[model samples]
Target: MYSVVVEANVQYEKESFTIVGLPVVPIKKSKECILSYQHTLGIDITMKKITIHLSPADASPPSQPN
Candidate 1:
């Protein structure tokens, strides 16, 4: 299992989400992963514009909030 650094995105006017910074597959999965964590764990995580760079950049990308 690889840990991919994921950044979140919320579509305007709609509650839909998008995950950026990971491989397309994992990033897609992150949508559910993050939503579950926030919903069940009660972490009101929201998304805004960001810039990411993960260590070993290829492994996982990190993001900086703007």
Candidate 2:
């Protein structure tokens, strides 16, 4: 198994949200959930650059034996 860490950066820019660094499908789909939470918390981030980075960015599964 591998240990992964998540880091988020929010910057001022034209409205956009992005997730980088080898995110899985479920992670990509979590945008709506996140936005909902943000709304519930009363933090409007519609006009900012949101970047979520997953690190060690180059993680990969071990190769199988031949």
Q: Which predicted model would earn the best lDDT?
A: 2
> TM-score for all predictions?
0.43, 0.60
- Candidate 1 has its poorest 10 consecutive residues by lDDT at 48-57
The TM-score of candidate 2 is 0.60
Candidate 2: segments with Cα more than 4 A from true spot: 1-4, 22-24, 54-66
Local accuracy by lDDT, each model = 0.49, 0.74
What is the C-alpha lDDT profile of model 2 across 1-66, one tens digit per residue? 556666889999888888766558856666666777889999988789999766563566447999
lDDT of 1 by residue, 1-66 (tens): 654443433433533344444467755565666567778987653443323322223553336799
Clashing pairs in 2: none
Candidate 2: worst-modelled 10 consecutive residues by lDDT: 53-62
